[model samples]
Structures are given as C-alpha cells and as structure tokens.
Target: MPQAVICAYARTPFGKHRGALSGYSATELGAMAVKELLERAGIDPASGVIDQVYMGHVLQTGSGQAPARQAAMNAGLPVTTPCTSVNKVCGSSLKAAMIAATEIRAGVSRMVIAGGMESMSNAPHFVRRARRGEEVSYAALESVLVHDGLKDAYTGEAMGNAGETIAGEHSISREQSDAFAIRSHALANKAWDEGWLDKESFPVGGLERDEGIRPDSSMDSLSGLRTVFSDGGQITAGNSSQVSDGASAVLVASEEAAEEHGLPVLARIIDYATSGVESHRVMSAPIPTVRNLLKRNGMSMDDIDILEHNEAFAAASCAIQMVLGVSEDRPSDIPIPFRNPCTVLVRVRLAISGAPDQLSR
Candidate 1:
C-alpha cells in the first residue's frame, strides 16, 4: 500500500537575520515547527504517531547534541522515536521529506516527520590558523603563499573572488543578472499577494512575514548597485536570497496509519531522484534530477502541474528551463509557462536578494 502524506508544514520566513529568532538554536527551530505541526493536527507529540524524525542542516554550529534527537526531544516527542539529519546540498530538506515518505511506504515506520533548517545568520565565521597562532603567522611571513594551506575549495583563489570566474565562464550579462533579480522580488511579491504561500507557511515567534520580500525595487533603482565579484562582473547583493534563519517540516504516514488518524494530506511524493553534476555547476542537478525522477515514475515533464525550482541562480534556472523546453510569456505582468502541448503553467516563481555568488557560497 502507498504511504500517505498526513500533513505538511514549513516555518522560518526565509530572510537574512537572526533578530527575534536569534536565541533559539537550530534544534529549537526544528522542534518548534515539529511541535506546532502536531498540535495543529490535534496529535500528541509524544504519541507513537511519529516513528522517526529526519532533519537536514548544511552548517552545524555545534548546537545539537545529536541534532535529530535534540529536535525530537525539544518537540516533546517520544524518546524512543529514532531521528537523524541528512545533508544533500540545497536539496537537504526536500530529500529529508522524501526519505520519511519512503520509510512509511516500506512499512518500516508508521509515521515520520522530515524537513530542513538553515540559519546562515547563525553560521559561524571561522578564523584561519594564522589568525589563531603567531607561530603559523611567523612561518608564513617568510614567504608569499608558503603556508601550504588549502584554498577555498570552490575557486582555489578565495570564495568571494570566484564569482568573477563563474560569471565569465557562464557569460552572464550585467543587464540579464539585474533583470533576474528584479523578477525575483516581483514574483515573490506576487506569490504573497495571491495567498499561494499561506498553505505551507507556519508563523514562527519572530517572523510573521518573509523578510525576503522587497516592494521598493525597480530596475532603475537596481542599475546603480555596485558589483561584488569583480570590476565588470554582473553579480550583486540585490540578486540573491538573504542569509536567512528558518526551518520547514512535514509529516508522513502509512496509508493505513493516516486513515486511522484521519489526517489530511497535501501532495503525494511519488518519487525522488538526485544526481552529481560539476560541483561548480551545482545548479545543473535539477535538470538531471527531474529527468531521472520522471523516467523512474514513467512520467514526463507534461505530467507535472506545478514546479518550485529553488531560484539559486537566475542563469542556471534560465538554462534549465530552456533545456527542458519550457517557455513563458509575461502579459499583464502575469508570467505563465507552457506546461505541455495542451496547457500553459507557471514553471518557476522567483525570489532573491544577494549576488549569484551567494548561490555557490
């Protein structure tokens, strides 16, 4: 029997600050959402309804004493509920949800909670060895580049300067990059206006609203912004999502379990697939990922009714859509894509703030 989606919820207004949400640890954020989800569904957190918790975190600021278990403990769930954390780059949380669903479907678990949390604001900045030790500094003082230290893994020249290389290699034009940034704010604003986001959003203590939304933006206003990657590079701060503090979680259960609990489900996770692309070209994964997923399910692009492509980089997104043959026409300021031969749909809704470098970082 197929597993059922008991319920799904995501908290953490995607933004760049830790202000009101500051004090809470990553485990705390996950726990808060997990608890809220159970309470809203009128389920007891400590009940056996949840058999496990799967969380996703990119940067661990040493908050969790066993992050997954910490989240479950914080949520007041049963101590016996096994928990774990998963990291799949940007796909962290989404993959976590899929894994929980798989467990329920396989009869290994009756119910599970899965999601991801990233608090980039709380992500600590590390000081290099030379900064921490005078001996290392003195040894390096004798020669330039003599520390024999590993450089930024991405660029081999420092992470910040690597954006220029990517921009040049990708041929991302200045105007095109800015236009993408503008579209993100506009589409995100539109999503809020349409109430499309209300379905998944759970209000956290600090964020009743997503801080990423920018209304006072215009192409002209963005034109004068300075580039951070290089002298003539296109990337800028306004074109990316902020270093945010938030978490999202969803519940899954076996079909029998959901029926017994009388839980309402959202969408079914029919299948999930991922791939390894050139790490620098990480954005390329969605293309192959979706292709593999559809292939495994015996489905095609035409079968999807909606898509939520994480707008990591505008150029990458544009490339993926073009590769998939997705075309959109914006009229009356409404953007709709050609979903299939028979119908038109919106392929992606953009949301951004900082430079394209933000994606790689």
Candidate 2:
C-alpha cells in the first residue's frame, strides 16, 4: 500500500463574524485556499495533476449545489476533476483530509486537494414552514448557523449547553476555563507577532491577520461575562470559541506521486480512527476517540509530542486534559479560532516545523 503524505497546505486568516471575510461566500474562501495550495506546491493550474477535490462545509443550506465543485472550478482546477463536499459537522474538513488520504493509500487517487471552509457570517436564515402554503400569522426565522451547525440534532440542545454539561461533569472550574482562554489568546497573538502564522496563511479580503484574538483578555474581564448556556453556567462567551469564517486546503499525494512531481512531503498519514459516545456527551467524544487512536497505533500519550484538541469551549479542552492525564500546562503552538478549517492550518505548521509530532482533535 502506498503511504499518503501532505505535500502543501494553505489557509486564509480567520475573520471575525461579519468582519473582513464576510463579503466572500464559503466557496470563494475555499477557492482562495486551494489557489494558494497549488501555488505553494508549485503545481501549474493546467497540469491536471490533481485527481480529486474534497472539501468540508457546514451551513450549506443556501450555499448552492456542490460547493466543493464550485470551489475547485473557481480555483482553476480542471473541470474534469471530481469534487466532494463532506459534512461531518465540526469534523468536516479533517474528515475530508482523512478521506483523501484513504483514497491515496488505496491507490484510487494519486493526488488530491482536501480541506474545509465555512462562512458563518453569511449563513442563511430560514423561515420555518414558510413554503408549506399554510396560513400563519407569523413565520419564525431560524438561524441556520445555530439550527444546523451549532445544535445537537438528536437532543435539540445547543452546543454551548452541551459544553456546559461536560464542564460540570468534569469538574472544570470557571477560573480554570478562563485561564485557558486567556492563554489561548495570548499564544495566538504571540504566534501572529512572531510570524509563525504567516507561513501557512495568505491574505484574504484585505484581511492579513486573524481578527478574533483579544490582546487584552484577562481573568478579570472573562469572569465578569454572563453565561449564555445556562442560568449560572461556567461557560461564558469570553472562553468559548468564536463565531468566525475561514478556509483551509492541503495537497495530499501518494509517496510515489510526491517523488515523481518533486513535491515536498510534509507529513505522512500513519493512520486514523473514529469513535462515538452518547449524544449529549458530545464534548467528551474526543477522550475515547484519542484513546482508540493511540491504542490502534500502539502508542501512548507519553509517546505523543503534540496534541491539538479542539477548544470549542475552554471546558472541552480542560475535560480532555483531565481525563487523558495530560498536564494543564501543556503548550499549544497554534491558535484554533475556527473549527474544521484551522485543523489543516495546524497540519501545515506541523509539517513546516519538521517535527515528529502526532496531532489529535
């Protein structure tokens, strides 16, 4: 079996909700990242070397038909290239890459473009039952972002509320969560200032930097914010993931293809696994998932050098750390502002640094 490796990757700087990147649709953002990936990999647009395109996208209600196809066409990939849009919610883009790697490893594809994109700023609103031809006094408008992207379909509970439950179960305190949020922002700002984030990102919509980082974030400030999920919940807006827009793309190729094209192999895809837990314990899913991944790979937490668990809420990260026996002081190199899109960017950083690290989210 051929090994799959990442040859190149690029991402647009995450834009705050309704901020710099609001003008572009999700497909447009995806196209920009794909274009940047091709340029960085030194692949000519006309080469037709790209065998497939797989892009993850949520909030696709009004984005149109075949968003991945639109992104590929917009990025100048030959129309002959096949495109797939994945929708595993928060894991969409990461799962896209995983699918691309599986295809490459199985010898079905030689080269592929895989990543994720989202435009929360432009996610559409829906008038529930408006098209039913029923006489109603009012039509309720629902946020597609919340209804589709940020809510648990099975339980109808908001994701933040789920995070709150996880935090409560795990005994994660407000102070601890606040501290983690503060550290995340501080590290993100530092990464930007040190030029680490610049290597993997390209300017988009006149925005060259991530707009969500708060340089003045402090425990005092975070503590004062009221909780949005529950009456007295510890999960506050200051410590939760931001509503942001961004895109990321990576070129995945078989080792033989990389050698033939002279493309640099960033990192090899050793293996991947997925697991599930109770619906309401969504935030705790990573705990068992990571454990299964490590067990299957015959590795332990001690053997892993870097971990990039999603910080959807500070409580999620705190819960993972506590259960996995990871130290609270462990430093994360990348600032994960958006969910699926930023995963590819983190992989880019890992490859560029030439570290023998394993990433889990």
Candidate 3:
C-alpha cells in the first residue's frame, strides 16, 4: 500500500468581505494557490505529472461550470488532467484532501492537487421561482451565502443558531466565548507579526497579508456587541467567524512519487475519519470525529501535539475543548496559538515525521 504525503502548500492571504480579494472569483483564487503550489513543488504543469485536481467550493451560485477544471486550466494545468469539485460544506476542502489521499494510498493516483476556495464577497442573490415565472406579485431576492451555505437546510435555521444551542448545552459563557475570540485574533496577529504565516502564504492581487485581524479587540469591545442569532443568545458577531474570501492548495503525492521528483515531504497522512451528529449539533461533530480518529489509531488527546481545530464560532471552540479534555497547559495546543484569518473550511493536520518543526517553507 502506498502512502500519501504533502509535498507543498500555499494559500492566498485572506481578504475581508468585499475587501482586497473581492474582485477575484472563487476559481481565480483557486488558480492562484494551485499555481504557487505547483511552482513550490517544482512540478511542470504540462509534464502530466499530476494525475488529478480536486478543489472544494461552497458558493457556486454565479461561478461557471466545472470549477475545478476552470481553476486547473487557468493555472496552466493540462486539459488532460482530471478535475473534481467537492462540497461537503465546512469540511469541503479537507474532504477534497482526504479523497486525494485515499486515491494515492490505494494506488489509484500518484500525484494530486487538493485544496479549497471561496468568494463570499461574490455570492449571488436570486429570486426563487423567477425562472418558472411563479404567479407571485413580489419575489424577494435571497442571498445564496445565507440560504445555501450558512443555513441548516434540514432545520431551516442559521448556523449561528446552532452555535447558540451548542453553547447552551455545553455551558459556554459569553465571557468565555469572547475571550476565545480575542485569543484567536491576538494569536493570528502574533503569527503574522512574527513572520510564521507568511511562509505558507503568497501574494494575491497585491494583498500580502490577511486583512481581517483586529489587534484592538478586547473584552470591553466584544461585550458591547448585541446577540445575532436569537434573543439573549450567547453567539454574537464578534464571537462568530468573519465572512472572508481566500483559497488554499496543497500537493498530495505518493511517497514513491515524492522520492522520484525529489519533493520535500511536509507531513504524511496517517489516518482520517468522519462522523456525524444531529443536524442541530453540527458544530459538535468534530468532538466525536476526533475521538474516533484517535481511537482507531490507538492514540489519545495527549498524543496530539498541535490540533488545528477550526474556530467556526468561539462557542464551538469552547465546547470542543471542554468535552475533549484538551490540556490547557499544552504549548500551542490548537488554533488559539495559530489561528488564521480565514476561519472557513480550512483543516490541516500537521504531524511531522521526525522532529516536530514549524511547517516547512
């Protein structure tokens, strides 16, 4: 059985909603990341070295057909290269990488490009039944981002409402949530200031750094914000994820292919697992999923040196920490130490092979 390893990784600096990256489409952003990733890996796009390309995209309302193909061709990949677009909502890109790794481990592919892209700034609005010419006097234009991407289709509730439910169930207070949000922003600022994040990032549209970090955020400022989801809700705009646009790409290649091409192995995929919970408890799914993954591999929470859990909402992050028994003393344990500006579907497990070093440049 072949093993899959990440040879290269690159992402565009996250642009705040309608900010620097607003002009670029999701496919264009994906193309930028894919181009840089191939260059970093020293692979020629026309050489047919890559067997496939998989890109995850959520808001595809206005984007043209075959998004992964559009991105690959825009990045100079050969038309012969296969492309797939995946959408598992918040886990879309990670699922893309997981599929690529599965194919490589099964000897179905030698080399693959896997990543995700999103342009919430460009998510379109449409009037329902407009195409069918419904016999209605007025049809309100609905936001695709809010309706298709952020809302729970099963329950017809916004994800923030789910966050509120999770917070209530887990006993996460508003103060705790606000503090976590502050820590996330502070850590992101620190990482950028210390030049740690720049190593894995590249310029896009002349934007050199993430545009969303608020260095001046504090408990006082966060406390004043009103609840968003429900009356007296714990979830607030300050504690929820920012609506940002960005793209990330990574080269997943078989160990044999890496050795042949002399590509540096950044990390190896040991094992991955997926689990689900009740639709309303969407944010809590990671808790059981992570536990199952560790149990299957005969590992424990203590064995994980750095867990990059996505902070979709500060409430969710607090819930996971409380339920998992993650040690607060562990150095750089989770996103609290390395939170990125874009808080959407970006999931990467960095368990280096030998000595655990900073993610290689």
lDDT of 1 by residue, 113-184 (tens): 887765554555433566665455333442111111112345444232433444455565667656766776
- Between prediction 1 and prediction 3, which has the larger lDDT? 3
Whole-model Cα lDDT per candidate? 0.58, 0.82, 0.82
lDDT of candidate 2 over 13-130, digit per residue (tens): 8888898999999999999999998999999867899999999898888989999999999999988999999988877887898899999999999999999888999998888677
- Write down the TM-score for model 1: 0.79
Backbone clashes in candidate 1 total: 6
| All candidates in order of TM-score, best leading | 2, 3, 1
Q: Give all TM-scores, in the order shown.
A: 0.79, 0.94, 0.94
lDDT, residue 231, candidate 3: 89
- Cα displacement (angstroms), candidate 1, residue 111, comes to 1.0
Candidates ranked by lDDT, best first?
2, 3, 1
Candidate 1 Cα outliers beyond 4 Å, as residue runs = 4-6, 127-172, 329-361
